[model samples]
Target: MQQYNPDFDYKSAAEEVLAIEIAGLKQLSQHFDTHFVQACQTILNTTGKVVVMGMGKSGHIGKKIAATLASTGTSSFFVHPGEAAHGDLGMIDSNDVVLAISNSGESGEILGLFPVLKRQQVTIISMTGNPSSNMGKLADLHLCIKVPKEACPIELAPTASTTATLVMGDALAMALMRARGFSAEDFALSHPGGALGRKLLLKISDIMHSGTQLPKVTADAPLTEALLEMSEKGLGMTAIVDADNAVIGIFTDGDLRRLLSKRVDIHDTTIGEVMGPNPQVAHSNMLAVDGLNQMQERSISALLIVDDGQLVGALNMHDMLRAGVM
Candidate 1:
């Protein structure tokens, strides 16, 4: 290993590497032609999953490409070429599409399986730096990722070429995503444990405080009583409802502060007299992320959930934070 040079301009060296990678991506973007469309169409028309195969550093990029395809509505998974030869080739079918990746376009492990894949009549899409390499020539379609040069000083490590390959994979995934009309909800279902899942799949009913957990006071109740309810519930606000439990207004800490500034009598004031009428509210079925948007739009910290004009639940920014809905 080379020793670190304290006086060397590491920032400039890093910027040069970035420049090479950027150039590679720009080159990749320009090469997106009919072959790219054909590859997308081939994958889209496949009834079975996309079976991505590669070796070495290409295998790492292939795995990521497979994952991206799967999460964005295209069913896909990575299979190491060496592993496929051992037995995983059985996982491929006539209806499946194979996405083989190699910078040199000569991965023997992958090329060795070409005959078997052809026998199965599976569609092959090769992504490589050479359009005429054995893998490309044998494939049904070839997508080139040839870059101007590698970012490595010795041109030994897979740097700019790998970056180009990854970007090409991304381009394919996104194009297929648009072609399939994949929505955020669709993406959320595939990523139930991720942040996008929480935002899109989580509903107000899933995280709201319902029943006795909801802070409420009748329209005729005193401001002091509402304050006590707000404190006990710890939501910093209380819904002011009518005799039939329908939401009439809301009173929050901000309301109380304004009342204090006006020197109003908390003990004598009716909740209805001081409450904010027609408060911003959402239905229990609304997406928690939508509720978040409502609060943000109105510049409020809390929201009351209602259904059919009846107060059903309440939630605040703190609840959104705890539920991972923010």
Candidate 2:
């Protein structure tokens, strides 16, 4: 008999599932030995894409694994077994490698499509719990992801097994990525809309203000005139440049307040006299996230972009903030 309580025992239920899945993953570590290396070598050596296919929960995991592989330098895509029967198998090239995922290693839909893939001489990689199953036996390389039991209390749901399979798939993707020397820039290119992409792909030139938009004035200009440029531009600061348009100084809103504290008259002072000399500058080629770092470190909100010592552009924290780089 069980007593009903207002507090459902979700914590214990979740913890038990996690504990079982963690153990299942640990068991999978042994399978990542020589067989795993051979599978990766086969995929990397071939000049072809990877085709990941499965059904049900395994299909979901296979889709994500395929995506991870694609984004990390390997060309790959997911194919539903049912879709393959309906004609999506045309996406697979003769040179492509087929990666089939099945916890039981006996999915009828996958096995039914195997003959055609085999006839085309496509290299096959199988991930399954049973080594003797038809899918495992027909593969060129096999990864065993056997689990002791399901984490589900009824021992019917695919919890621990699916988690183990997904982790193993990720391990394979990353292993191939590192083996091929895939760099951060490569990863950034495949994920240009995400955080790492913005950090690595967005250059200072892409977001900086230039031409008439740059807040700047000559050294001989009056402080009052520089103030007008700063206000017109609305960046709260103006760069003081020389005849060659090389940035020489910067006058910020904070600096204006400091001058006011000294009782200096803006109308009488020259821009050069009030500006901070040789202020820090950035290059347009530098990454925008790095520019954000420099700004934070210097306790400033904007930076001047100079190329070969000539002022080319300017940027503020607002630009980076709007770009979502921060």
Residues 1-326, candidate 1, lDDT per residue (tens digit)? 98987899999999999999998888787779899999999888888999998899999999999999999999999999998999999999999999999999999999999999999999999999999899889999999999999999999999999999898999999999999999988988888987878999999999999999999999888788889999999999999998888988999999889889999988888888989999999999999999999999999999999999889999999999988887
List candidate 1 stretches off by more than 4 Å.
Answer: 1-6, 243-245
CA RMSD of all predictions: 2.0, 2.3
TM-score of each: 0.93, 0.92
- Number of backbone-clashing residue pairs for each candidate, in the order shown: 0, 0
Give the clashing pairs for model 2. Answer: none
* Whole-model Cα lDDT of every candidate shown, in order: 0.93, 0.92
lDDT of 2 by residue, 206-247 (tens): 999999999999999998899999999988899999999988
- Looking at model 2, residue 293 earns an lDDT score of 95
**lDDT minimum window of 10 residues, candidate 1:** 22-31
> Which number leads on TM-score?
1
TM-score of model number 1: 0.93
